[model samples]
Each structure stands twice: as structure tokens, then as C-alpha cells.
Target: MRGDTEWGSIPGLVRYASERYADAEAVVEGRTRITYAELGARVERSTAACMADGVRPGDRVAIWAPNTLDWIVAALGAVSAGAVLVPLNTRFKGAEASDVLRRSGARTLFVTGTFLGTSYVASLRRAMAAGGGLDALRVVVLADDAPADFRTWKDFLAEGEGVGQARVRRRWESVAGEWPSDLVYTSGTTGRPKGAVITHAQTLRAYEVWSDLAGLGTGDRYLIVNPFFHTFGYKAGVIACLTRGATMIPQPVFNVDTVLANLAAERVSVLPGPPTLLQSLLDHPARGAHDLSALRLVVTGAAVVPLRLVERLRDELRVATVLTAYGLSEASGIVTMCRRGDDPAVIAATSGRAIPGTEVRVDAPAPGEPGEVLVRGFNVMRGYWQDAAATAGTLTPDGWLRTGDVGVLDAAGNLRVTDRIKDMFIVGGFNAYPAEIEQLLGLHPDVADVAVVGVPDARLGEVGRAYVVRRAGAPLTGEDLMAWARREMANYKVPRSVEFVAELPRNASGKVVKGGLRGTPATG
Candidate 1:
């Protein structure tokens, strides 16, 4: 690896993979299988196209598409051209996509027409109509050939000759001006989304450390189901394969039947995802129809995985190489992970240890008790973009990142997460941030004031519930409020129930005493 082996930089590692395993399969989606040599060729072609299209060093190229071969190709291409890559989540609506695109100041965008029943092109058109036109966005490349206003992928790829080897070599040798790579925008749980500036050095370090621990390398097959917009999919899913020359099987869209078939068809050796994704695969009625005998390693984290689901993968699926890791976007996703070949008890009980070269410390511990976690390593982000005050509050001057998570590291160096320090909760293992719910709840016509709290549940661990003060003239019942929430949010994020009250209990500073409502017997 000639490039910076830090967290954010993985281009040099990709170069290494191409050199070492040039003929091996790099990306496989549907009937398309691209070898490392072929993949690198595509990356080079796209990089040339990017440069020809006026993408420059430090420029932002937003990849706004679902998980597809083109998404990975565009990401690597933009990075190779010395442009920053900003991956947009497919879940975002037109307004959300426009906000991210506008904030990122992207010069070029690669979009898709359709994805899993979602009309992506329609959304983009709507975004443009809403005044967030692609003014700075000079080039728009469509992933699939369709009758759209954008150019086709083939035409885009042909813009640059594949003979820019000299230019690429020079740029690789003196890859200055830009910092390997940069990922902006935080998956906001609070107010608005702030860009978290992660340098290439920081990102590469996180991937290298994790790849070593997970024992990934050439000849290994890894199936990636998570979206690349998130850290878990980008670092662990994509970079892990590139750095180690392992085969990467990307799913354009998540389908239980499709995944099950691919796992068997590809003979995938390693599988990693959030608990819900894995559970859906295992619980699928057709899961047993596939031959998954080649599966050896199974890694999962992000949300609290049910013990039963873990045990089922082990007992029923016959996968012995099972491990779980913990991380946050701020830490580049995988600061701590269960070591390979550990005892089943340890694997199930703890989130493993801090990855090698990363420092993990708990601040504000209450006399032998664990408090908030603070991390220092190449994995931590540089800072929150353009928000010095918020950055100062979250990141210490000494470069330690405040994780806002409560966890204890036992004497054996294993970490056990207890709860979050902030007012947030997890529903069905997905983070149901309280601020977002409060914002949505406030939109109710009859809602005067509202506060959201997490209540304990056996199946989901914690489910969100709302307490509200209705407007005097507005006729809003608890049932109506609950129904309204269900219409706006994903099923898991919808509150289980709503309680209408005259007023909510607030402290001297106007902060609601949410703890008081947790175990209250009264509904209102």
C-alpha cells in the first residue's frame, strides 16, 4: 500500500488489490461480474470522464443512487480523479436529497431512474422544480439507460481514453491538493444534518485495522447488503474488499430471495449486516432452499442484534465464524468489534475490544461506573463541518471524540454498551432519534407541545411513545396522533402509542422530564 493507510484513504490500497489480484472478481451484481483488472479499468475510465467533465481536486461529486455497480464505480472514480465523493442515502425524499445536494455543492451527480418501487428520477425532477436545481451540477449521468435528460453511463465512460496512465501515475505519486477522500453530512439525530469531515487518512486507518482483525484477504468472498451511504457499508463492506483483494458481492436492492440465492450461487464466505437485515434473511421461508455451506464468517453490528437471531445463524445456518462489533459514524464505523474465534459466550455478551491502534476511554465515570465513551484514533473524524461550536462540544481539543454512548470496558478489554447519553432510543434495532420524532410530532395540526420517550419492550428492547398537549380548538385524540405518525415514518419508527395531556412536565430550563414518563402507570 503506497498511499496513506489512514482512515479516509483507500485508493492506494485499491491499487494494490488491482496489482496483486488483477484477474480476480472484484464486484459481482446480478449477471455482471467485474474482475479487479476490469474494475480498475472502469475506475480509470470514470476518473478520466470526471476530469474531462470539469471535476477537480477538492470538488464534490455526489453519487445519488441505490446500491448498484455504478454506485461503487462512481465512488472510486470520483476519488481517483481527486474529487471528494458524497454518497446520498436512497431513503431520502426529494426535499432531503435536494438539501444534501445543495449543501454538498456537488459539481456532478450520478443518479438512477428507479429503485425498488421508488421513482428516483421523479424525485430528482421534483427537487429541481423546488428551486434546488443542479446549477453547480453540470454533469448528470444516469445509471441505467432510459429516456431521461441525463447522459448514459456508456457515453460518460467513453468521454475519456483509458490511456491516462501517465496522468494517473503522476497524480498518484503527488496526490496533494486533496486529502485522499472526505465524507460530509452527519446522519443527524439532533436538529439539522451537519457535515462530519472525515479525511482519507482517518478512513483508511479504520479499514486497515478492521480488515486485519476480521482476517479478510484474497480468496475470501464477502456479501454486502448494507447501503454504502452509511459507514458500515462503505468502510467495512467496500474498502474491506478492495484493501484485501477479497471478492465483493453487492446487492443493488435488498431482496430476501435474491440475497439467499446469491449467497448460495456465489458461495459467499463472509456475510455482514445489521441485525434486521440478517434476521430477514434467516427468517425468510425460502432461506433453507439455498446451499450456504460455503459461509464461514458472519459479522454483524450497528443495531442490537437479538440473541435468538445470533443463535439461529450459529445453530441452524451452521455458521461458526460469528462476531459482532460496535462503532459510530463519528468513529468511521468500527472502533470496537468482537475478535475472531472468541468464545461464544464472549461474542454474545460483549461488543468486543477497541480495534488495534484505536484508544477507547470512558469519561465522567461515576466511581467504578462507565459513562460516556471517548475515542482517539485515525478513525475519528477531523471535525464537524462549519460548526465549530458543536465540534468543540463533541470533540475535545486533544482530538478525542465524544461518542455520546454509555459503555463499560471490562478488565478483559471487552466493551458492553449500556445506553445512550442523549435523549434517543432504538426501535427494532434502528436508531429512532428523539429530535426527529419530536419534529414530526410537532407537525400535527392539534399538537400544542409534545415530548417523546422510550419505553422498555422485550422484543424491541425500547420503543418510542409520545406525550402531547393538544391545541384548545383542535380535536386531536391519542389514536389520531398515533395514526398520523404511522403515515409519515417507517413502520419501526412510528410510536406505539400517544398520550394526550393538558401539559408536559418541564424543568427550570424548560427541558421535559422524560425519565418521569418512562414507567408512569397513567397513560396521560
Candidate 2:
């Protein structure tokens, strides 16, 4: 059955999964294990808490945290109470996250206290500058312990106890499939991130197709190494599991040894993440020490997939199914997917055919030629949140979405994405936009100008390389600038190397010639 038809809304799915798979294990985070029944009860408490905290239908609720059971419960609880979810990237710095929450006018925020040795609450407070920037946000709940002004997870949940389950059920049942589910923010070539508004119906239908294509089943132990903020992890990993009753083991950070330990300990059967993750596992020196016979499904994309990698899984690990897919945040994060029984060569070369109800086309000379990929489907987003100009530019009046990705459509209907028209590249698994990085680099006082380009990396698939022009009389060095970048942005976005140039190459129109910058010599 179509997920939308079966459950109608996410709240409906939560209720059904709770009843049907009550005793089945739902999530495993370290020593913490929770059954489907426990997850449902937790979600219900969260929903009531949201209502108690002034969350209403159509309000925007944001969560800035990693992949954990608390993140799942807090986000779902808000959605069940009819608030549109806005998932912030855990890698984003305080200013980056603050900007989104301010733009979205998020009514409440659920954040982690400290993660990876940094205090997230303090970071956001610093970025907010004495709370002057966030007037809309009424409450801040911490997943760990409450600070001076914020509420703790325990205290937050206790407030909902006064609100009965009957009232919570009414709030959950009031949600319709047509209501907006999430506002997924994605940066474009313009150097600003825009939120893509996706509806409940689109999310449900898309991931249902994802689960069916990936062959997910009940009781399958899934180790989700992908960050929950990305659509790949949240929908394909979380939402897909809800439909199939699979066990979720969310790994907050990507560590090879931790992944191996979880796989062997939990008998993980489904592992879906970027190609780099699988490649790391295949090359890990300690891989043979773990009993990995139980691993059966692997879904990877966001970078090139070598045919040898596919062959190795079957030959060495004995995985039954391995698939690749293509998607973007604007299209509900799915476009095409490789089926279960596809040939290894085809799976490596193409992203398979379009989903059941969508149409794919390319503006090119012929089938083999490359062009801008266009899609029209139920999966396309409503539009960029409150930005009609961007919506008009992205969507045609005839209903086709102008995907900025460059791709070639074969005669067999398979899509092979070749390049990015927006100059976006995937570093490990994260999308790195050159324009965004260049803008950030321009913030340095000693830098006269900057241009960033994607450079080939053996391990990360791609990393940023910046060609910079130093201001006259400035004594800044490449080593000094790179260290500055580490403190400024996410680690993946920091350029691996930098080169000082006298001037940047540009055309008559004055746009930076990135192709020339891509050839600039690195300092190392």
C-alpha cells in the first residue's frame, strides 16, 4: 500500500506502528534500547508537551541535534502535534543554525547541550548576540540538562503529563496529509540556504517507494550512520523503518571502529549511507575481526560507486542487495533508484529508472548527451518557504522542476548524473557549494578575493581547494587561513589546501573562472 494511503499522516503511521509492532525493537543507541510501544508512548508525551508549550497546528518547530532517540522523539512529537519540522544540520555553527531558525521563525527549539566538546547552547547564544535575533522562539529545550534559562528533556516531558493522552490523540488525528511536514534547508549557487517545504503526503509516498526498492523488512537491524538532518537518513533510514518495523541504530558520528562494533554486536542487516562509508568498511584493517555475516542490504550514493566495490560486497561480505539512488532536498530527496536485482555494472553506472509516478527528462541533443535534469512528480516540494521568486525560478508553470544537476538519460531510462550546474560537490557525504565557501572565505580581512573549486580526493571523493588573492601588504599564509576556516565553518567545508594567486581568472562578465581555479597549484 502507498504510505500516504495506509497512514495518511506521520502521526497516523506512528499510531499504527505502535499497535502493530508493539513488542518489536525500534531503536538501539548504545546500551539504550526501546521497543515500538515505548517509542510510541514517548512520542505521545512529546506531542502533549508541544501542546503544553504553545505549539499549534502549522507552527514551525526546529531541532538542532545529532542522530539519537531523543532527536527522533522530539521531532516526531512536534510533528504529531501539527508543527512543521525544521531539522538543522548538526555540523552547522551557531551563526549558521541561528540564521535558519530566525528565517523560519521557529517557535520552539530542541537542541543538544554539548556535542563533540562544543557547547551548542552557548554557541547559539553567542550567535544570537544577547537573544536579540530570535524574537519568535519562545522555548528552548535541551536534550541533556537545562542551563539557566532552557528547560531539560525530563522537565519538558513532565509538562505534558497534565495534558491527557486523549487530547494528544486529537492533536495527532487533526493533522492532514496535505499539511507541510518539514522545511529542509539547502544552499544554492547564490550562497544562501533556502528551505524546501515538503508536505506529509510527499514524504510518506517517497519513502514508501524507497523502503520497497531497498527491500527493507520487519526486524531488520539498521545501523544508520548517515546524519538524521539529511533527507537520506531521516526519510530513507527513519521513515522507511517506521513503515517496515525495522530496528534503528543511529550512529551520531561516522567512525569506522564504532560502525564495525555495532554491526557485529547488533547483527545489523541494513546499512545505508554515502559511498565513502562502504569503501571505508571494505578497507578497514579490523573488518575481519567482526562477525559480519548478517549484513544483507547496502544503499549508497552521493558520489561515484565503483563496480569493484559492488563485486567485493558480494564476494567478500556476502551482502544480498546493494543499490544506488539520486535525489535532492527540493524533490522530497528521491528521484531514481536501482532495483534489488539489477546488474552490478548497471548499478554502478546509473541511478536506475524514475520512481512509479514521476517523469524525468533532459534538455539535450540526444539520449546519451548531458543536459539539465528536469522532473515533474508528486514528490516535488511545494516551493521554497516564503520565497516566491526562488520558487518561480525553480518550478516551471507546466510543473517541471528545473533541477540544477547536470545528467544524461540513457535510452533505457537510466540516469547518470555527470556534473553540477551550481558548482556543488559532495565531500564525503555532505554537499559543498563553492559559492557558499567562497563567500565565507571573503570574510577574512587579509584576503582580497577568493574562488573555490572541487578537487579530487582519494578518501572523501572530493574536497574544496581555494585559490586566493592576498591584500597588498598583508602577511597571511595558506596555513594560517586554513586554520582560521576550521574555526569558522563545518570541517568538511574547510578547503583541504589553498594557493595564493596574483589575480583570479574571470571572463568579460566578471564571473570567476572556476575551471581555471581547479587547476591552481596547491600549497602542499
Candidate 3:
């Protein structure tokens, strides 16, 4: 936290990390462990390759692959060559891929032929052919040798490829003027996802804050199972590892056994996963069989974790520290993180106060209550790419980002999230908090998990409907669940109907897909 310098750009962050930990392992993909020295060389070669193929400053170069070394190379390569990287979600279908590609106007895409059982090249080809300003597509670099309209990684990197420590430093100096490094598309829950234009300065500041707060250093190793498409993966996983000189264990997808095994094998010190992943790790019968003694820090977000679950982690897992982060794509990932030394109540119920440089304030408090969460920080994005109206909606005239979430700050300055402004509904002229209902429903004996949503009603104007996942071997009908809720809550708060499900639909980032569940019947 004491380190001070004027270099606030992402390329600068890469330079600093490379200089500090030149020979240290920067990333590990299965058997391949690439040191910062090697990482710099690869990024340099990859950047030169793109530049040779006519990519210029501000050109959009997309990485349309799953979590792999090639993904990191391409991302860093694009940034180094003064091209803003656009990362497409690997979970996206042809249509979704096409929309993102066309909208971003990416000139080149570094792709992996087949990753996680999906043919990325095939989908990219189809998407490109369907068209919009993608005809200028110059090169496609494949990680593995697959016969196609493209060059292999070895061949591509041969373009003006230079080696040595001196060259890596020189390559970084060439692109230091480029402010914004990546154009990332936020997972649009409503309408087409707009790209949050993140600058190099913004992203570096985010990683700096993260590195300082987590006390990360060259000795640490991070297990990154999150997808590269999300901000958490980029800022928390990629940038955090780079800034701190920590080795990154890249996983293409979340595999419970493999993740646990890697933590032991890699001796991973920093671990970040969604609550769902943590729940599985804790619930696994083989959990005690594995070695997690090396695991020191655990951080989670993307959803409100249950207090009981957090308590179990602290008590049973014997973790040194556990933190819950509150972030958004617009803010370059982390705005606030529950401090490692925070109380269990704050750790369980809130995402804690803003990080050192960020400012968080309530927009409009309801007479003696919480209000909409507003944030202002260097980490905040310049604006949504090419959508002035939507950009205006999020960024206020005073520069504060009006995050759609509602929260309250206690006397200690810990921020407790209450609900989403968009999710809140008026019921009988009174606002109903779906999160409150869902939290209560989650406490039911038969309920494994629950999500509450507002539905249009002829009489009540809008009423609550509950979607639940029953605990294993527990049987609870819709009527039984409704009756149980009625006994525990007031008439207005009790769910009018209940639907049982195996699991809730979630986005790539693991947030519940509430919009997807809107039109379904009361019981499934």
C-alpha cells in the first residue's frame, strides 16, 4: 500500500510486475507454467504479430476463446500493441457471439479451436460470415494446430518476434500512452449488453487497490476458475495476479475435484469463487480428504452468500480470512470489499465499505432507511461503448455511477445490500423487497435455496412468487411451502405461490437469471 508511482496504466502494471518478478511464474495452465519473463516474451511476440497484420492503435482485437494461456496472451498482446481487447463470452451461442463481434468491430480474433467441448473457431466463423463490418478481419491465431483459415500460434508469433528482457521493457514503453486497454461487454440481463469501456488507468487502479487490500505478493499463487469474460476474472484474476507477481492457475471451467486438487498441487494461497462453488467445496464428502491447509484467503461475490454458510466456512474450514466483494462491470470489478479483519456480521450481511480510493454514498434514503448505492471512483468506466443515452443513465452529471443496487451504511461504515432498485416492486402501494423474502425463504427447513420475484396480479397489483430448490430427500409441495412461509412471515411478506426446482438459472457470472424466470407458471 505504501508503493507510490505516477504509472497508473495497465501496460505499466505489466511492466512493473515483469521488472519485479521477471523469472517468477505468472501463469500455469496444466503442465505449462509461464514465468513473468516468458509472459512478457509471449505478449511481445503476439503484439508484434498483430501489428504486422495491420492492427493499429485503438483497433479492437477480440479473444474468442475459453480460459487458456492463449486468452491471456491475446489480451495482453492486444493491449501492448495499442489495440483495445474485446473478449467474447465462451458460453455465448452463434447469435450472441455475432452480436458482440459486430458491435465491437474487432479486426482480429485470437481463438482456440476447441475448448471445453465447444468449437470456438467454428462459431466465430459462422458469426463473422453473418456479418457487420467484420470483413476487414485480417488474422485468426489458433492456440492448437487445426486446419482452417488461420495461422497457428507458433507461426503467428514469428512476426517480428523479439526476445530478451530489454525487448520486453521496450515493448511496454511503446504502448504506455494508450489509456483504455480493453472493451469488455457486461452480461446484459436486459436487452443487448453494452460494452463498458475500461481504460488502462482504470483497470490498473483496480488491481492496485486489490493487491494492497489482499496483501498479495510474488510468493502467493492464485487459483482462477472464473471465466475471462467477466470483470472479476480480468481484474481479480488476471490483473491481480500480474500486479502482485502471483502465479495464476487457469481452469477452463469449474470442476470441484480438480479445483480442490489444484489448490493442493499448486499450493494456492489466494482463492476466489462464487458462493455456489464454495458451497460445493464445503458440502463435498471428500472435502476433509483433500489438503486445503495451504489455502490462506477466500473471497466470494456475485450473489449474497448465506450467513450460515459463511459461519460454516469460518468455523469448519479454519480459513484465515474471508471477504465478500461488491463490484460491477462499470466500475472495473471491485469497488468495495469486506475487509479481511471485518466482523462476521459485516462479512455475512454486507460487501463492506468502499476500497481506499472509492467513494460510496446513498442516493436517496427512505425516511431513516437505506437508499440506492452510488459510487464514484477512478475505477469507474468512462461510459458504455457507443450508447450515449444508456451511458447518461448510469453516469450522473456529478460523475457518480448510479449503481442500480440499494444498500445502507451502518455506524461503522459497513455497507449492507438490501435489494436491487430494478427488482423492487410495489405491492398494494407498498414496496416489497424480494431479497428479504428470498433470504427468509432460504431459512426454511426444506429449502436448499430460493429466489423471490414480483409478479403482476389482478387484485394486489403485484405480488411475490417464490422459486425454490428443496434440500436433498426433503419433500415440500407448493402448498406446503406457502403454508410454511405464512406461519413465519406477515401476510404481505409471505409468498403467494411457490415453485420447486432442481436449481435456479444463472448467468455466466453466477448471478440468478431473474428475467429468465419471469413468465413461468407458479409451480414447475
Top candidate (lDDT): 2
Candidate 3: segments with Cα more than 4 A from true spot = 1-8, 162-171, 187-190, 423-524
lDDT tens digits, residue span 393-453, model 2? 9999999999999999888899999999999999999999999999989999999999999
lDDT of 3 by residue, 1-524 (tens): 42224554566766677778899989888889888988876777776777667777788888877777888887887787778888876656555666777788877877777865667677667766777566767557566575566777778777646444465456566665335688888533244568889877777767778877777777888898887877777778898888778998888878889988988888888888777678878888888888888777888876666798788888888778888888877888877888878878778888888988889888664533689888997778899989898899889998999888888887677777776766865454333567756776777888898888888765455689998999999878888888877655435667788877789999999889998888788874
- Backbone clash total for model 3 is 1
For model 3, the run of ten residues with the poorest summed lDDT: 1-10
Model 2 segments more than 4 A misplaced = 130-132
TM of each candidate vs. truth: 0.90, 0.98, 0.79
Candidate 1 residues lying further than 4 Å off, grouped into runs, are 1-9, 132-134, 139-141, 145-149, 161-163, 176-180, 187-189, 306-308, 366-368, 427-429, 454-464, 476-497, 519-524
The candidate scoring highest on TM-score is: 2
Write down the TM-score for model 1.
0.90
Candidate 2: residue 127 Cα off by (Å): 1.1
